[model samples]
Target: MNPNPLKILVLYYSQHGGTQNLARQIARGIESVAGCEAVLRTVPKVSAVCEAVESDIPAAGAPYCSAEDLKTCAALALGSPTRFGNMAAAMKYFLDGTVAQWLGGELIGKPATVFTSAGSLHGGQESTLLTMMLPLLHHGMIISGVPFSEAALGQTRSGGTPYGASHMAGAEGRPELSSHEQQTAFAQGRRLAELAVKLAV
Candidate 1:
């Protein structure tokens, strides 16, 4: 008999493609684990106008995430570009709508992690990652961060922290991830997947 692979949700919102790249790296890490699959998803852009809207399907990139995706994911990795030391409004908007899942305890006990991209070295990367956990905490998801054993967290000059994987995407726009950033993200993903397997058992 064959068993189903565990699904780990990779969800994020990116404006200049920086955060999205981090999401992809995290997904690669999650998929590296045997019996685990990464389900990459994104949220639609938000608008201040009450009636402003976007197409249900994005013109490019990952499909928008749904409540069902959250319900079914064995684990989750949330990413977003930093906005004044916090999660971007688009990602925040998505999390704000998860009350149904919270009420049903759909995410309780599942493992989760977060990632971010910022224009400057000190551009709230850690703060954004920290704040991103609030909604997951409300959902009762088990949260984990990069361990010191992941040496990249200590050696990275670009972007990396014990809080989560991060990228220092500078003023030019999205640039290739630094080696440390990539390694840290992959490490985080692997860690999350490993914990998910243990928890599921």
Candidate 2:
């Protein structure tokens, strides 16, 4: 019998829609691969207090990420909006809650990638991407980044980095990803999904 299809989880936290848009483009890229699927998930916003006000299930958009989703995923593409050169608190909060999975080594062998969107060109896109990877690295995940072979990396005047996929949203909070940025993000997802498939069996 044929084994189950590979599933690449596209997990993200978006405050102003930029990160969400990037996640969608990456999902499209993941689905473009044969024998692979993209499971989109989101982390809810964190409150200043110890407990958040959100319900167990989100009212809209993708559902909150479950630990099972992380364990069962063939690959992972994590994204978040830039927040002072780091991933937003919400995403970090979600990851911090994954201690059980980390101790179990559930994601140790999975291929992973990172992505981010910033309000400005120099708004710590790369640093934000790097920060998002730290916890995954601690979980022993194999990290993958966009190779320079992708033309978008060279031509993108807006946002395209070898660290991962990125976007430059103007100060007005506009999230019009450039052709290069979008292509690079898609390529990242495709590469992650493909690598996950290769590692699955």
Candidate 3:
């Protein structure tokens, strides 16, 4: 790793592994940068009736994210499943708790990105991605999208968009990410990581 590499936080909520899968790919993109690294973290679920209950740490996978994680990262890539063209409640709940960081301007001016998974070809991927950025914007974080310079955006018949990285989950989240969608995600990560490094300098 490059000394003093930019640390990009890959924070997300994944249910049934769909969003988690996307998170891994995005992390790969971040690590490709010479002076940047990806830190994978997750948020616990929220309950409707009862207060959210979670252990001190997740049983498996990356550690649970803390506000300190936000402070340390040079850039961010947030992910969540599509909930009626919006971010999942759990992810939103987590972001809502970041007002302390917002007040401190911790994430302001950081380059950031977003991604999502939808159950169908038209299942609100782009909108969910854009909505995910709203909180980040309020924190003054810069946003990035998949530009057309990536051919995958033009060629993908499945889930590729100018809004951000996305994947089609189909019913039960069956189908795998199409090649174009995968490439688009990798391209997004690479772009954001590169941007983070440039901005850091």
TM-score of each: 0.96, 0.95, 0.95
Can you write out model 3's per-residue Cα lDDT over 43-141, one digit (the tens) per residue? 887886424457768889889899889999999999999999999988999999998999999999999999988898999988899888899999999
Q: Could you say which candidate leads in lDDT? A: 1
Which candidate model has the greater TM-score, 1 or 2?
A: 1
**How high is the lDDT of residue 181 in model 1?**
96
Any idea what lDDT model 2 has?
Answer: 0.90
Runs in model 1 deviating more than 4 A are: 1-3, 49-51
lDDT of 3: 0.88
Tell me, what's the RMSD of every candidate? Answer: 1.5, 1.7, 1.4
lDDT of 1: 0.91
List of clashing residue pairs for candidate 3: none
Q: lDDT tens string, model 1, 1-201?
A: 118999999998988887888888898998889989999999988886622667878999999998889999999999999999999988898899888898999999999999999999999998899999999999999999999999888888999989999999889876579999999999999999999999989
How does each model score on lDDT? Answer: 0.91, 0.90, 0.88
Residue lDDT tens for model 2, 61-157: 8888888899889889999999999999989988999999999999998999999999999999999998888999999999999999999999989
Model 2 residue 119 CA deviation in Å: 0.4
